[model samples]
Target: MKLIDLNPQGGIGANSIYLQIGDVNILIDSGLNPKQAGRLAMPDFSLIKDISLDLIIITHCHLDHIGSLPVIMRQHPNAKVVMTHSSKMILDRMLHNSANVMLRQKEENNIPDYPLFTHEEVDRCVPRFTGMEFLQPQKFKGKTDEVEIMMHHAGHVAGACAVELHHKDRHIFVTGDVLFENQRTLRGAQFPSGHFDTVIMETTRGTTERQVGKERVNEVSRLIASINDTINRGGSFLLPVFALGRMQEILSIIHDARKFGRLVKCPIYAAGMGMALADYFDEISRKYQHVQFNRNIIKELNIQPTARKLDAGKDLKQNALYIISSGMLVERTPSYTLASGLIGSDKNTIGFVGYCDPDTPGGQLLQAKQGEDFTFATANVTTKLQARVERFELSGHADREELAEFAIQTQARSVVLTHGDQAARDWFTKELESKMPGSKIIDPVPLKTYEL
Candidate 1:
């Protein structure tokens, strides 16, 4: 069996991996950088074109994991798309929403390479998807023989899974963004203990030790308390979060805190796609009992519509506590506009709750030196909002120790790391090598293939 690494980070690429076993070819997680839209067109399948892909398995609905689905399906119309039922639903909604946003931005900014695929393409791709339940093994007979596929809960998102493939007496496990720490919206990843010939793992947060589990909850609570204190003094609190997992988790936690009287009963407004995702969370809460908020509690969580345009400064000024998305604030989303408008107002506090790419505008803001002022243009008016910016150690990925523990438990002969920056991957590789002296760790470069 051969595994190919398609995309890495730091312009290295994104998350796309190709696995070829004898006559069968399987592509896992076809992703693309949002900044490079046109480049996400169908990949050159010449290498595996002759060998028809038997299946395409998606780990989750995150754009970074399933963004290039339309392109891939357009290229290989016969390949079957496999994912969890919940993942498929979320993916359908996410792709449509993302396409709409891309088109709107293209039309407004006259940016080239807008939506790569039309809504019809997304529709075509949707029907091809086959939802598989977790832990249920599916048998796929290739032109040669049968290949066994097993899906395990990844716990990164609502329906994410880590795929295990068995063929020709070989066992390979693909870890697609596994989560070690449980959050308010999702449970920790489930591992199937067994010896494997090869294991593919994601190293998104390998370099740093994630905030200790117990400390993280405390930090979040403390940050909210601080914000509430400011709000009690007639101030507003702004929390910029990702519209997906992070937003839902934060809202659930806040709701619980308020219910227990840990925080004030101030108005909590959820903005942007966050509002929609929160509603979805409420709808699906019944199915995933491990999620932090129960159906009744999530039902009571308040959600406010996101600002429609870039200049909706007036809408932001009225809320006591607001949660907005486009987590990194790279795009001109409602969060960015509102944050720009309320920054300098001593009456407001801005908090960050997700990973931020340092090159993005939001990352710069997060790392801004003390006493720095930022100017924001809103509603044809320029306002300098100088508010305190703080970050909480709330991440969906596993920490160094957790990754080591997972690797130890897997007991795989060969370990491969993907989906992290060079430094992070290197650090993790070293750590794993020292801890597991008997196991071999390999960090694959883009397009680099390793055989097991």
Candidate 2:
């Protein structure tokens, strides 16, 4: 058996990996960086194109894992696509939305350097999906023989999973963004306590020491209290968050605090898809009761949108607490426009909820270098917002200790780390090697192959 890292070497972007066993090829993920389309750079598929691809398993709906799947399927039309039911549903929505965004950008800019696939391609790929339930083992027809596969809950998102493959006398495990402990929306990753021949793990947060659970919650509470204090002094709070996991978690926290009278009853505005995602959480509360604090509160919380539009009228800006999306302050989002309007004022506070790419405007704001003025863009109007900026340690990824403990407990013969920067992967490999002797740790460069 051999493992190949096809793209996204060094964990910056565009992640793809291939597992080859003789003539049988199993493609785990086929993601591409967004900037590649403009550069017209295509992934090299010469290694797997000659061999018959038996299966294409997707771990989750994140673009970095499943983004290039439509194009890949077009190249290899016979390969069977497999993922969880919920993952398929979310993937469909995400791909369609992404395609639409690309098309819109192409038209708006009149540029020919956008994405290659169309909405029609996304539509065709949807029917080829085969949904697999968690923990159920299935056999697929390989080029030479049958390969047994198992899907386990990864706890990253709704219906995310880790893949386990068994063939001949060897077993391999692939962890796709696992959460070690229970979070607001999903259960922690669960693997059968046993030894394996090889294990492939993601180390997105491997280099950093995660804040303790209690400390995380306390930090969020304190930030909220600070916002509330500003509001009591006749100010408003602005939080730009991702519309997915982080948004739902923060909403639940605020709702719980408000229910117990820990927070004031000011109007909380949820802009963009956050309102819809919160509703989805409420609708699917039963399925995720294991991770929720109070399912009843989730059901009863009124998550109505306070600001219907993004005009940024003075009255609207002065009254409600706003939670908006495009957490990075990217274009075509309400958060960017709002930030541009509120940055010069001392009556508003901007709270960053999750990780921000350093190149993004939100990231620049968080860095807050010495003697630099924060700027935001709003529909051709540039504004400077001078509100307080703060960060809360509410990441969904597992901490360093949790990841080390998980690796030690698995006791695999060999470990391969991915989905992190080179520094993070190296740190994890060194620490795990020192703590757990006799286990081999390897960090393969992008497109490199390792034989086992």
Candidate 3:
């Protein structure tokens, strides 16, 4: 098999992969980088512009996985696009939201290349999407070769999946953004057992060691306790989360805490595409057995919309719980602006629940010490970091040990790592080399082709 990493900037950004087996050419995903703006945020489609793609497989609906779908679909009009049934239901919504964000960025950030694809372009790509049931084998023929494709349930978000490809007798698996542990509203990943010829996996949490006594259940309790402590002290608590999966999952967890009287009574403020996605999650849960979210949770929690314009360095003093988006606290986002105002106060709390890229504001804050000077550059606010900054092990990715064990158990002759920073990939490379002496471990460079 021949492969190329199409993400121009690499390091978990613009996550597109090109694979060629026999006469078949496949594209795994077309994602945009949240850190970069305009055309630079998208995958380098120019690498495969001349090649006729046979199939496009969408692993999930996260912006980092399917953000550039419309761009790729426009170039490969003849290629077939496939995703899990649940992903198919939410793909359009995610893309439309992305387009809207790009349009706003174009004006706000002064990027002329913003709005890479229009809403109409997204609509045109929708008719081509073919949703498939998990583990159901579907065959696609090339000029002289064919491959059977199947998707397995990968517990990261509502409709995430890991791709399995069978070309002739050689088996290949691609682990998209995956989470093996169960979350409040989603079950753990249900991957197949056994061996394969080649394995491509995500190494997201490679640098994060598995700590003892910090499992999901315990972490949930700690989070609730922290929120209660902050609320009772008459201070607000902020949860910076991704709008797609994290928002819904965190809200569900909080609802359970309140239902059992384990949480304190305080005003809950949440608004964004995530709130709108609750309706879709409710629909998905009712129609499918895999998901477990209900839109009624919003009503039960008495959620309120966040104030339209949040001023920097000015706290509202509501003593409320704020759950907002741009999980990594990207510049100019709701979380970034609100955090600027709340971080100077010693009474407030800011807790993170998912992976944060080292280059993002959230990661910088995590590395900062209490009473240190922190700067919110975009908001023009600089102050002493007095607020409580905590991180829960409630990430949406599997632990490094579990993922490495899975790859080692597969015993694939060639193991390739994707979707991680350089440090993360390095850790996985060292771990795999020491344990699996006979296997070939690869970390492909961006836009570089490798034959395995």
Candidate 4:
């Protein structure tokens, strides 16, 4: 088997992999970078432009995983795209939202190459998508070779999956952004326990250790208590989240807390793509039984939409809980704007609940010491970071130790690492090498091809 990393910049953005097994050619995913603009954000399709792709597998609908699907589909018209059934249900909506965001960015940021794919293009790509069920093997034929593909539940989001492929006697497993611990809206990963010839896995949480009392259940309780503390003190709490899964899961957890009277009585405000996607989550919960989100959670919580225009560096002082998107607090996002306003005041609190890239504003804020001056360059606001900034261990990705254990158990002859920063991948490399001393661990450089 031969493989190439098509994500030119690597480090978790524009995630794409090109693999050739026998005569079959496959593209795992084609994502876009959240921080970069224009064509720079997408995977370098030029690397595979001349090769005719046989299959395109989608692990989930996260923007960082499927953001550039339309572009890739257009490039390889004959390729068949496959994902879990639940992902297919929500895939078009996610792509349409991406298109809208790109359109808005093109105007707001004055970028000439924005809106890389239009709504019509996404609509056309919808028909080419084929949804598969868990553990159901589907065979695809190339010019002279055939491979069987199956998906397993990967608990990071509603429709996330881990791919398993079989070609002759060689077996391959690809863990695409997985989480073993269950979340409120979704169950934990249900991976098969066995050996494979090759294993490819994500190293998202490689550098972070799960501290003793910071487990998911305790973290939920702590989050509720902190929200009550902030509201009682007449300050608002901001939770920047990823709209696809984290938003729905957090909403469900908050609802459970409020239902049991553990949460304080305070107005909850949520808006943007997350709220819009709630209906889809509800449908997926009912139709697919993969997710457990309900639209009624919003009604019961008396959720209100955030104001259309939030003034930078001016606190709203609503003393409410705000759950907004762009989890990394990317520039010009709703959370970014609101954070600028809230971070200046000692009364407010900003809590993060998911993974944040070290280069993003969220990661920068996490590393900043209290009383330091933080700048929101896009908002033109620079103020002392007086707000209480906290992080709860409620990330969607699996813990590094758990992931390492899973990789060790596979006992594959070769292990490939993807979807993490340099430090994170280095940690995985060391751990895997120490545990599986005889295995060939390859961290392929971007655009480089390696044979195994």
lDDT of 3 by residue, 1-452 (tens): 99999999878989999999889999999999998888899999998999999999999999988999998999999999999999999999999999999999899889999899999999889999999999898999888999999999999998899999999889999999999888878888999989989999999998999889899999999999999999999899999999889999999999999999999999999967888898888898988888899988899999999999999888889999999997899998899999999988989999999999988999999999999999999888998999999999999999999999999999999999999998999999999999889999999989999999
Count of backbone clashes, every candidate in sequence: 5, 7, 0, 0
Candidate 4, residues 244-274, lDDT tens digits: the string is 9999998999999999999999999997798
lDDT tens per residue, model 1, 1-452: 78777663432234677888776788888776654545543233444556577789999877777776787777788888898766865788888876787788678767687777788888877889899878889988678877789988888778788999998888889888878668878888887886887888888776666554546778777777877886877778888887778778877778777788788766766676766776667666666554554445445755555446645344356647887787877556778777776776767788887767665667778877656655443234344545778777777777667777778777788898887777778887888898778988988766666786
Deviation (Å) of 192 in candidate 4: 0.7
Give the distance in Å from residue 167's predicted Cα in candidate 1 to where it truly belongs.
1.4
- Residues 1-452 of candidate 2 have per-residue lDDT tens digits of 88888764357356678887655689997775543453233344666677667789998776667767887898889999999766765677777766876777788766586565778888998999998878889988775677888998787666678899888888888888777666666677776667788888888776677655646667767877977886886777888887666677777777767878888767667776656655555544545443453335434655446455665424355556777887778765778767766665677777886766555778777887433565554356544545677777666666667777777788888898888777788889889899778888988876677987
Better of 2 and 4 by TM-score: 4
Point out where model 2 deviates above 4 Å.
34-47, 109-111, 211-214, 278-316, 377-385
What lDDT does each candidate get?
A: 0.73, 0.72, 0.93, 0.93
For residue 447, give model 1's deviation from the true position in Å.
1.9
Return the TM-score for candidate 1, rounded to 2 decimals: 0.90
After best superposition, candidate 2 residue 302: deviation in angstroms?
Answer: 4.8
Pairs clashing in candidate 1? Answer: 343-385, 343-386, 343-387, 344-385, 344-386
